[model samples]
Target: MEIEVAIAGGHGKIGLLLGKLLVEQGHTVLGLIRNPDQEDDLHAIGVEPVLCDLEADDDVGEAVAGVDAVVFAAGAGAGSGVERKRTMDLGGAVKLIEAAREKGIGRYVIVSSMGAADPPAEGGDAFGEYLRAKAAADRALVESGLDYTIVRPGMLTDEPPTGRVEIGSRVERAEVPRADVAAVLAAVLVAPNTIGETFELISGETPIGDAVAAL
Candidate 1:
């Protein structure tokens, strides 16, 4: 149970929260961050930070080396344009899959969006394009031949973690806290039954443990 897990966007809202929980559960967490300055933030929570750029670097394999599982939480952000959306959201995920394959790491998890399964039919705006990019990335992971779980959460909020969630193959739009999403991601990472599954999450009655165990 002392496996090592790495989070590609380790400093991100969900990634950082998940890293803390993983460390507390007696797992070693390696957080891949673009800024070396963020090392202190991760170290403060007992996470080992590995500095690497997911979009523009060639060291993804090295960044994720020796980890038992990987969680890709990287994104280009709302202010970013179309190219960045593809380069970071889609391209970043593909690189991680390639690295996981190259390094012999089988377990992979992705922090995706609810609409990723089906991109918007007619729009090229940022949100529309973002969904398209995510859909592409999700497809890549499924075809990567790796043990993967794609957790798509609806409207992200900054509220506190509910420790409960509603999980299904596809769910309606609703808001869930970033903290809850992090907790669910952490749970999904170690749940063997969750492998090869893609689910959507939102606020609900089922506890995190039960939600994932029932996967």
Candidate 2:
């Protein structure tokens, strides 16, 4: 089934890759990006770009209005402060959730991080805050009553995709390429069984389709 998918943080590495894949699969993809300069990049991959800052936009319903599904892939980068973690990581997700609900869009997928379930102590550190933010966002999505899937990936690398992965409710910590993560996200969107399932992702011997199907 070809569906329209709206991806928040659409210019991010994984988002771009996912958009390209979706478009190649004959799905209409709308990439929500904060910077207008990134529009061409999205267009280059056949993803229509919607300019809207997740942090500043109070009402993002317009961005997701007619999409069949929504994906929250935004984050506060490594150099960001603690407050940005709260606002961007957590708050941005909240905004997207609210918008999805208001638009009556049921399918939602969030790209979360490992260790978000049990984050380290909040010692005024940025990384700790980021994990806590992801945890809170995950909680919100679970309780939102939407058809949601939370994918928590281990350390991300920029290497080429391996097309294989290990997915489970809990998995040992390891690294996976961003391309593989994007492949997993695309698979999850089309797999109805993945709805309401949250899992950890990492490099493994299992093919991506089989891994997601087994989920």
Candidate 3:
């Protein structure tokens, strides 16, 4: 089943690969990017780019206008400060949820981090702050009355795609490749059983195909 899906921050590491995979799978992928210059890259990869700043946008409701599903994959990457972490991670997520609600779009997915359910103690580090923000956003989305899935992945690596994965209520202690993360997101997009369930995933030396099948 091909769906018109909008990927917020579709140019990031995991987000970019997910957009490519979705496009290859015959899904209409609209990438929401902050930089206009990023559109060319998306176009080259067959993703239609929609320019919007998640932090400052007041019209996200219109931006997502006709899409069937929404994937919130945007985040403040490493080395970012606390402000950016909150703005893009938590605040931006909440804003997008409101936009989805106003537009009447029900299917939503959030790319989150492991341990988000239990944030680290304050004054820890930037990554700690990020987890707390992601947790807040995940909780908010679950209560928003939208059909949503929150994917909490462990430390992300850049290894090539490994088809095998483990999916459960909590994946707190493992490292998963970004390619596998993208694959999981793509699978969830079409898997009816995964809807409304927050899942944690990690690669386990199995083929990506077999891993998805196991899910």
Candidate 4:
């Protein structure tokens, strides 16, 4: 089924890969980007670029209106401080959720971190703050009553996709390629069974499709 998908943080590594994959699959993809310079990048992959800053926008519903699904793939990025973690990671996700609800879009997917569910108590650094923010965002999505799937991937690498993964309610921490994470996110979008299912992702022997199907 061909559908329109709006991706927040569309210029991110995983988001760009996912957009290309979706476009190749005959789906219309809209990439919500904050930088005008990134428009051509999104267009190069056949994704329509919508300029909207997740942090500054009060109502993003207009940006996502008419899309069949929405994906929250934004982050505060590495080296970011605690405040950016709260505002961008958590706040950005909250904005997307509200926009999705306002537009009456049901399918919502978010890329989260592995330790979000149980962040370290002793660490008061940026990474710890990131986990807590993600946890809060996950909670909001779960309670939003939308058809949402939270994908918590392990340490992300830039390696090529393996096309195989291990997914479960909770899995051991390990490295998974950003390409493979994109593949898993694409699969989750099309799999109705994945709705309301939150799982940890990592490199495994199981094919991406089979792994998602088994979920």
TM-scores vs. true structure, each candidate = 0.97, 0.98, 0.94, 0.98
Model 1 residue 213 lDDT score: 97
**Which should have the higher lDDT, number 2 or number 3?**
2
Clashing pairs in 3: 163-207, 163-208, 164-206, 164-207
Off by over 4 Å in 1: none
Q: On residues 83-169, what C-alpha lDDT tens digit does candidate 1 reach at each position? A: 888999999999999999999999999998999988987686999989999999999999999999999999999999889899999
Cα displacement (angstroms), candidate 4, residue 20, comes to 0.4
Residue 86 error for model 1, in Å? 0.6
Better of 1 and 3 by TM-score: 1
What lDDT does candidate 1 reach at residue 23?
A: 92
Report lDDT (CA) for all predictions: 0.92, 0.94, 0.87, 0.94
Greater TM-score among 3 and 4 belongs to 4
Better of 1 and 4 by TM-score: 4
The residue pairs found clashing in candidate 2 are: none
Clashes of each: 0, 0, 4, 0
Q: Per-residue lDDT for 92-137 in model 2, tens only?
A: 9999999999999999999999988799866748888999999999
Each model's Cα RMSD: 0.9, 0.8, 1.6, 0.9
Cα displacement (Å) at residue 148, model 3: 0.5
